[model samples]
Each structure stands twice: as C-alpha cells, then as structure tokens.
Target chain A: MTAALAARDLVVGYRRGRRARTVVLDGVSLTLAPGQFACLIGPNGSGKSTLLRTCSGLQPPLHGELLLAGKDLRRLTRLDVARRVAAVLTDRHDTGRLTGRDLVGLGRYPYTGWFGRLEGDDDRVVAGALEAVAATHLAHRVVAELSDGERQRVMIARALAQQPSLLILDEPAAFLDVTARVELVALLRELTREHGLAVVLATHDLELALRSADTVWVLDAEHRLATGLPEDIAAGGALGRAFPTGSWAFDPVEWRFVFCGTVRGVATVAGDSLHATLARRILEREGFVVNPPDVGPGVQLAIEVLEPPHAAPTVIARHAGGVETHRALQPLADLARRVAADARPGETPR
Target chain B: MLTEERVAAHPEPAPRASVDGQAPARGRAALVFPLLGLLLVVVFVLGIAVGSVPIPVVDVVKVLTGHEPHGVYHAIVFDIRLPRSITGVLVGAALGVAGLQLQTLFRNPLADPFVLGVSAGASLGVALVVLAGASSEATFLAGLGGLGDVGIAGAGTLGAAAVMVAVLFAARRVRSTITILVVGLMVSYLVASLVTVLIASADGPRIQQFLAWEAGSFRAITWSQLHVLVPVLLVGLLAAAAGVKQLNALLLGERYAATMGVDVRRTRFVTIGTAALLAGVATAFCGPIGFLGIAIPHLARAALGSSDHRLLVPASMLLGGTVALAADIIAQLPGADFVLPLNAVTALLGAPIVIWVVLSSRNAGTLGA
Candidate 1:
C-alpha cells in the first residue's frame, strides 16, 4: 500500500524576529504506511505538534515537501485536503451555543455546494461517524454542557463525519482521565484496524503508546525524526537518548524505565521458574552464597519453604553474627520488605 | 464534554435547507406572491378614496382611468394621492432591502439604516442645506421645486451617501464587528453635532422648517419628487435581489465562506455599497422612516422559517412595503385632522416585535439550538 502521508526533509518553524527564528523540525523525513497506528513522542517544544499541523496543512513548513498519497500537499487545494485528511486538534471551540450534532454537521461543508446543501449520503456519513465514536446518544445535548472526555469524543466524531482517508489527532488523550486514557488508546487501535485509516496521533503517554501503537515516530530533542516498530525502538535505546537527560533509567527487567539510583540498594525479585537457575548462577559467581537449608551453625538456612510446582517458595537465613545470610524469597514484595529492613543499622547483608 | 459530542453528532442543518441540504425552495415559490404589486394596487386605490374629501372608489378609478370627471376627485386622485402612495411603496421597499442587507452583512440583527449611521449621515446633509438656507441645487437637487430651490430630500440623500462612504472605509480596515459598530456610532455623533451647529445658527423660519422635516412627514412628497425616486429605488431593490445568493453563503462566517471559494471582501463591499445606496436615497425622500427595515427582515425570517435570502430578500421587501403602507394609513387617522409622524406609527409595531424576539430567545447570541 502507498504511504498515506510522506514528508521529505521537512523543516518547520516560525520567525521570531527579523533575523531570529525557532526551528521545530529540522530536515526530518518520514512516511506513514496506510492503516498503521503511528504514535509520535517527544518532550515539550520538540516539534511533535508542529509536524502534525504541517502534515494536516494547517501550517506551512519553512522547508521541505509534504505529499498526501501521490499528490503534493502544496498543490492540493484546501477543499481537496479537507476531503482527504481529517484533523482533530486540541483546541476546543465554544462555537456559540451549538449542539453536538450541529457541530458535526459542519464537517459536511466540504462535500456540499455553494449554498451548503446536504444530500442523503452526507446525512448517512454524519450518522455513521457519530455511531462509530459511540456518541449517538449524546447527539441531542448542547456542546457547552458536556464533560471533557465527552467533548473529546464529540470532536473525534466530527472529524469522522468529514470522511477523510487519513485521520490526524493531536494529543487525543490529553484531558482524559487515566481509565479514559487507556480506553481511548484501545479505541484508536480498533478504529485503525477496522477502517484501515492511516492514523497519526501525538501523545505524551509513552507506556500507552508502547502498548498500543504498531509504529512509533520519535521526535528527538535534536529536532530529528526517527521511525521504527515500538519494540525495536525501545530495545535500541532510542527512547533513552530521545528523552531529555533526567534522573531516570530504562529498567531492562521491567521493560520500561523507572527512577533508578534514587532508592538505596533495592532488592530485586524473580518468578519461581527463573529463581532457582538465577540462584545457582549467583552461587557459582560468588562462592560463599550457597548455604543449604538446616545445615550446621556458621550460617544456616533454617527455613526452605517450597510450595508445589508452579507455586511460590520462600527462604529465610539465620546468622550468629549480625548479618543477613542472603535471605531469598519467592515473592518480590517480601524480598523488597526484607531488603528494606536489611538496610537499617544493626542488620547488615554479608 | 459529552454534551458537545452529542451536540456535534446532530449538527444543526444550516437554516432553511431541506433534508437533502439543497437551497430553500420557498424563495422560488415566494416570487409568485406578487405582494408588492398587490400592495401598490390597494394603496393607490385607498389613497384617493380615504382622504379628507372622500372620493368614491369608483370615481377614483374613473379619474385615474382618465374619464374626465367634473368633481375635485379627479384632481385629488390623479394629482395628489397617487404620487404620494407610489413614493411610499418604493421608499419603503428601498429602506427594507437596505436594512436586511446591512443586518446580514454585519451578522447583527440590531443593524438598521439609522443605527449604522447611514440615515444620520443623510439627515446631516439635508440639515446642512435646509438649516443654512442654501439653495444650492447641486447639493440638494431632487425635490418638487426646480433645481435651484433644493429641498430636504436631496440633502438627505447626499448625507446618507457620505456616511456610507465613511462607514465602508472603516469596515474595510477593521475585522472586529463591535469595533465597526462603535465606529459607525461615533460617525453618527459627529454628523449629529454638525446638524446641531447648523440648527443653532439658522433663523426661526429655517429652524421651523427643519423641525417639520425632522418630524418625518410624507405629505411633502409630490409627482415631481416621484420622478427622481422611482428609478433610484428600483435600482436599489434590484441590486439587493442579486445579492441574496452571496448573503446566504456568508451565513457560514467569513473563513468558511472563503474556503468555499467566496471572495469575502469583494462580496462585503458590494453588499454594503448597495445597502448604503438604498438607505441614502430612501432617507433623502421619505425622511428616515424607522423600524420597517430592521423589523421586517426578522419577521420575514421567522415567517418563512428560514434565513435563505432567496426567500428572505423578497419577503422582506414585501413585508417592509406592507408595514410602511400600514404605518402610512395609521398616520392618516380619520379622527385626527393633523397626521402623526411616520416614525410614531412604525415604532408602535417595530418595538413590540423586537422585545418579543428578545424575550422568546433568552440568548440572542445564538438562535435557539
């Protein structure tokens, strides 16, 4: 399938003064495959929103060519773009006491003639769009009375009513609560799969993007564009470099970063199947670590509570001196608590 | 948020369009109503029959048909009432069309000939001539007297045109609606101050004459006056009719109209120019007849159940004529020997409708969703 939107060496910015300018995107080129759910991630002022606006034709790029399907974006008339690329911006308009349905009907303007006539097919498209966003029931309510999430959904419904081939949403989940955020991500995924729409969304929630999006478009701090599968990008440490330098690290074990070096000597835990093999390896590496359970008294492992296969196990160590003889536990929570206790004075790990 | 979503789901179809979203059909249907033609017929007949010396309708018809009746009815029907009533019809239609165009152009319902300062400008022109006792025919030439003895009508036209020019210039520079309205009001005050200075300096006779004109009587209109007004009024009406399509497209706001390939700036200039001509000329001859222009368009929109100018433009013209003619009849109340000022009768009908519209829709900011 042809790329729905392609940018070639795009540079986007605005002039600050006669001689000064701030560049949002510098020589960035990328193509979005048809029907793919692409998520763009970047820190503040990293040009994510600017790139989206340039692609949607709302803003002009300072340098570069953008093509929608096979046609160059600059050559296509605004009306032509309206029919091809539908956009849902973050700006909420108070369109003077209009109803949800009234706002959606405005989406039909591109399809209508000079007198703004709407035919049967136009009405159907409007209805179908509302239905797709599952906001059919809210159609009768006034826009001013809706909650934030409801308003966002209505905005999406309005964009859908445009019936464009490509959908561009900027910060779709910005105002949504945590649960709504998750649901919105899932809904976007389902919509892309069902309609085969080339979806380009800008979001700050990296976890949700990693879980839901097929491809990730990273706008690094250096004003460069990078694209790859989410897994490959995460594994290649692209996210680590792209994000601003901070007191955080990519926790390889957890598959996402956490604020490391903030806590002191944090205890790590493993699942039942991985624990025994890990323990054996640790023993070979450090010779004094292995003390078989119920053995004689220099340092004894008195309790080796082993549950059935697939069940969790726990280990406790007893020492004559003030030392933790490597207290091993099957559950990570218990290990964390014991390690936290060991960090206190009087008890030290050998 | 869900409310907006819900509201967005059922976007209000632009007013007057059918389910298919086609241009309103009522406009085409309204053309056959022939209301103006009918009103002309009634007012002409009534003008002769209902005067101080009552001529029978049959006698009036006979005199108009040139049967050469011996009685005073012949002189009254053919020479006096016919011209006055025809003048009223044209002037009324002109002001109505102008008011509708101004309101639509500004997207302001309260917009009217006088409020936008066009009428004030026209009055200022007339005041300068009449108050100064200047018989400059070029400045105030369209009247019953020969070109040398210019009357209030001619001066009024020049003043209105002057105001139109000023307001149009201001409108071109400013995009904000409230600022434009404020500018129009300030211009009105400037013109009013000039009129005041002229009135203060005039002798008692000139001042009395100016006061009479300010009272806004239609009794001064004559056959000679009709010659100057009929053609101008007709041109103004035709210009407004041609503007309906563009006006309807403008209902979507300027940016949206531009995207739809409308040259918004050009359309605005044309519509405002035509509106200025209509108001200027009407105020020149008939003396700032109030209320009909502003009230009639809203009444037409409400009656037609649509804002599509195809129906609204003509509907407003007829309605304006009807109201103006009706006001003229009330001005000539049988019991009162002296006729009331035309504005008195118009305000009676116009004010109530405006108040009711405001009351019915608590928020005039948006049509009831």
Candidate 2:
C-alpha cells in the first residue's frame, strides 16, 4: 500500500533573498502509513513547524520531493492536495458569529460545488467528523464561546471533515490543560486507528507524545530527523538528544524523560513496580544518583520502598549510621539530605 | 468524556440526534432573510410616498401602477421619487455588502467602505473633476454630455481601486487588523487634505458644487445615472454572492483558508476589487454616503445570529436597502419643505449601532477570539 505521506531527503528552510537560503532541517526522509499516528518533537526553532508546512504544501521544500499518497506533492492541484492532506494550524481566529458546526462545515469546501452548499452527504460527513472528535454537543455553540480544548477539537473535526487520508496539526496541545491534552492525543490516536488516517501532530508535550504516538519523529538540535516507534526511539537515545538537557535524561523503562540531575551521591534503590519507580524519581529529583538494582556493591546509602497492606507506602533508608524508616517521601528525602551533609570526605563507612 | 467512550465503542456511526436541537434556531434564522426582504419593500414604499408633496399612499400606488394622477403628482412619483427610492435601495445594498466584505477581509469589526478610504478615494476623484474642471480647457473636456458622467464614474472607480490596491498591498505586510485600520485612516486623512487643497484653490461656484456633493444626497441620481449605477451595483453584488464560499473560508485565518483550497491571494484581490466597485459606483452617482457601509453588516449579523455569508450577504443587502430608504425618508424631512443631508441622516442612525457592536464584541471577548 502507498504511504499516506512520504518525503525524500527533504530540506526545509526559508529563502531570504535571490541567492540566500537558510536551511532549517535537511536530509529528512520519512514515511507515514495509514492508521499510524506520528508526533514531531524538537526544541524551539528545531524546524518542526517548517517541516509540517513543507509537507502540507503550504510552502515548497527547499530541496527534495514530498509525495502525498504516492504522487508528487508538487504535481497535485491545490484542491487535490487539500483532499489528500488536511492541516489544522494554531492561528486563533475571531470567527464572528460562526457556530462550531458552521466552522466544521467549511471543510466540505473541497467537495462542495462553487456555492459551497452542503449536500446531504456533506452534512453527514460533517456530523461524523464532529462525532469523531466527541464534540457533538459543541456543534451548536458559537466557536468564540468555546474553551480552548473545545475549539481545538472543532478544528480537528474541521480537518477530519475534509476526509483526507493524512492530517497534520501544529502544536495541537499548546494551549490545552493536562487532561485536555491527554484527551486530544487520545482522540487523535483513536481516529488514526478507526478511520485509517495518517495523523502527524507537532507537540511540545513530550509525555503525551511518548505515551500515545505510534511513531515518533525526533528532530534533534543538529537538525537530524529520526523516525521510529516510541519505544525504539526512547531506547535508541535520540529522544534525549532531541531535547538536549544535562538535567533531564530519557528513562526508557518509564518511556519518559526524567530529570536526572548531577551526581550528588550514589544511592541504591530497592523495590519493584510503581513504588520503586516513585522512590527513584524522588531521589533523582533531589540530586541523588540512583544505582541500578543489580549493581549493589560500593553503595554506602540504600533506600527501599515498602507497601503495607493498610497504610501508605513507606520508604526505608539504610545508611552508614543506621536505618531510618518513614511513611512519606518528604521525611525520607530530609533524611537523605542530612546523611549527605554529615558524611565526611574520604570516610567510607561500611 | 462519556462521549469519547461511546464514540470509541461505535466509531462507524455516532448518533447525531443532538444536532436536531439546533433545528429551531436554524428555522428562526431562516425567517430573518424573508423578514428583511419584507422590511425592504415597506421602506421602499415609505421612501416613495413620504416626500415633500404629501401624496397619500393610495395616490402613490395609483401613480406607480400607471394610473395617471393628474398634475405634478405624476412627475413627483415617477420622475423624482421612484428613481430616488430605487437609487437609495441600490446604493444602500452596495455599501452594506461592501462593508461586510471589508470587515471579513480585514477580520476587524471596525472595517467599512469609508473606514478603508475607498469612499474618500471616490470623493477625491469627484473633487478633482469638479474643482479642476473649472479651467476653460477642462470645461471643454467636461462638455461631452453623458461622457462626462461616465468620466466621473470611471475616475471614481479608478481612485477607489487605487486605494483598495494600496490597502491590499499593505495588508499583505501587516498582520494586525488595527495597524491596517490605522493605515486606512492615514490614507483617508491624506485624501481629505488633498480635497481641502482643491477646495481652497477653486472658484466660488465650483466650491459650492463640491461642498454640496460632499454633503451627500440620493436626489442627484437621475434615471439616466441609475442606468449606470444599478448594473454596476448588480455586477458587484453578483461577484460578492459568488464569493460566499471564499468569504466563509476566510472566517478562519488566511493559512487555514489556504489549506481549505482557497487561493488566498486571488480571493483577496477579487474581494477588494468587488468592494471597491460597489463603493465607487455608489459614490459616483450619490456622494460619499456614510454609515450604511459600516453599520448594515453588523445589523445583518445581529439579526440573523450567524456569519454564514450565504445568509449574511443577502441579509445585508435587504437591511442595507431598508436602512437607506429609511434614511432617505428622513433626509426629505417629509412634513416640511426643508431637506437634510443624507450623510447626516446615515451617521445619526448608524454611529450608535457601530459603538454598540464594538462594546458588545469587546465585552464578549469575541474581538480576539
């Protein structure tokens, strides 16, 4: 089957003058298949939006060919391109007096005749698109009256109404709250799976992207594009380098980037599952270097997570002086801080 | 959230029974257009009947239906009132639709035909002809009978088109609608100063002619002039109607409109061109009539409660006609022999509505939504 969208050695950039071109991202070759949800993650100005615009045919690629549904993007008519690839941008419009359903009905432009009368089937398609986004209740509400999340869903529904095989969005979660962000990504994922859509969204919400996206497209600081499954990308370490920070590291096991501060001291964390993960997170956040489970030797301080049957999870810290047990992480953290402050240099107590 | 779960369970056909509730609002909105149409008819009749001569509605009807009302009633009803009322309807519709297009194109509530300097450009065109044409050689140039009227109309269209092109060019560079509005104001100021200069240098009778034209009136459009004005207005209105799809797409910003397969640049050009034609032709026949161009679109939107151009365009036309005829009726000062300036009547009726729309939209946060 033909890929929904493919780019070959695509170099995206802006032309400043007749002979001057500033390249943003180069040598980007990627394919998104139907029923796949991909996310583009990068730091600010890492060319995520430039890449999206190039792929959506809003701007021409500086070099290389972009294909939509196995046909050259340059060869497709504007209407044909619109029919194949629909994009939802982040522009806040003051659509005076337009209802949500009316906004979504605009997506029928590519199919409707010159007068843009919504035929019976067009109305059905618009309703289905609204339904797909779970925004049926908002259809009658004025677009300006809707909250940011509701408006975003209506925009996505507008794109969906195009009945395009490929959908692109720029920063779909930029203004949404945590729950709305999660719901939006979840809705996109559902649409991709149910409708065989190739969905590509550029988002700064790394956790949402890592958890929900089927394929991750990581654009690193050096302008390199890496594409793979979320797990594969996390394991391959490109996710870390994409958002390069000395304080944060990609935790492949958790499939999220966690703040791994400088090595304050090596402390062994002992336990399993959720408790162990929570304890490690607290320790790491407090500037303690956590030792792996199997590597037990040469660790002066140790902490264990204990889940009692009828109480809150407990944390037990074993140090050179003695062992301290606490029901909460804050007190345990305080204990670790005191130990780090007390232990003298070159004093290895076993 | 429950909707999400239900949608996930049955993705094929999510029930849309909730959409049925909007049917009543839609039905109510559907009634607005026809009501506006009826309002236009009533106002048009009022414009014809309530003139300087107190012709009763019965006599006005008789004269309109070709029954000869003996004496000056025939001349007043057919020659003067009929053409003037029709001109009011056409001019009002043209300015109203033009204002709607300008407002949507700039995405600014403050945008209108006069606000954008198109009317000022038209005024400048007429000023140049009326003021500078006082020279003997220029008088020979203006002595070409009907060609002189065409010349003024052509010059007015060219001037409006010129300002429209400049504004469109500036709009390409500026993203903020407020900045574009300021640019339009500056253009209007510059044109006003130029008209002032022309008035200062011209002779006494010429200055009087220019001043009377500047005051604006619907009385000057003879049947011969209406021949030119009506067809131009119709063509401009037709162009605007055909562009309903593009205008609707533009409710979302330019980028989304482009993604929806609307050629943004072409749509911008055509829309401004049509708006210019409408405002210019109206300014050519009547003077630079104000208020209707800026206020009618808002009235249409408020009445219909939708920005759907399919409804708003026609609604604006009918409402614009009604408002214009009503203003013309007041300008005639029906009970007395004195006349009022048409521009004064329009501003008196329109400025309050403009202020209300601005304050309400600002309070609703719909200005930046």
Across residues A1-350, which tens digit of lDDT does each residue of candidate 2 receive?
Answer: 89999999988998876889999988889999988999999988788998998888888889998999899988998888888899988898788777788889999888899889887677677777887888988888888889999999999999988888899999978788998888888888898877888999999888788888899999988888889988888889787778777767777897666766445566888777577787777776765667754555646578888887777898888988898888777887687677656644332221
Per-residue C-alpha lDDT of model 2 across residues B156-248, encoded as one tens digit per residue: 666677887888787666645567678888999999899899889989987887777777888866788777778889999999999999999
Question: In model 2, which regions exceed 4 Å deviation?
Answer: A15-20, A268-277, A292-307, A312-327, A333-350, B1-22, B69-71, B131-155, B168-183, B200-208, B363-369
The sequence of per-residue lDDT tens digits that candidate 1 reaches over residues B130-152 is 77644444442323223322456
Instruction: Record all residue pairs in model 2 with backbone atoms less than 3 Å apart, i.e. clashing.
Output: none
Docking class of 1: incorrect
Candidate 2 matches the true fold with a TM-score of 0.89
Q: Considering only chain B, report the TM-score of model 2.
A: 0.87
Q: By how many angstroms RMSD does model 2 differ from the true structure?
A: 4.4
* TM-score of predicted structure 1: 0.63
Tens-digit per-residue lDDT, A1-350, candidate 1: 77878888888887665777778878878887767899999887788877887787766678888888768888988777776677776664334334566556666666776545556666666666767777766665666568778877777777776666678888978778998888777777776776666788899888778778889988777776778888887887678767845545664345555443233232222234455445433322222323334334433212233344665544433332223423353332333335434443222222
Q: Flag regions of model 1 displaced more than 4 Å.
A: A1-350, B1-107, B113-116, B133-155, B175-178, B211-252, B255-264, B307-310, B334-337, B363-369
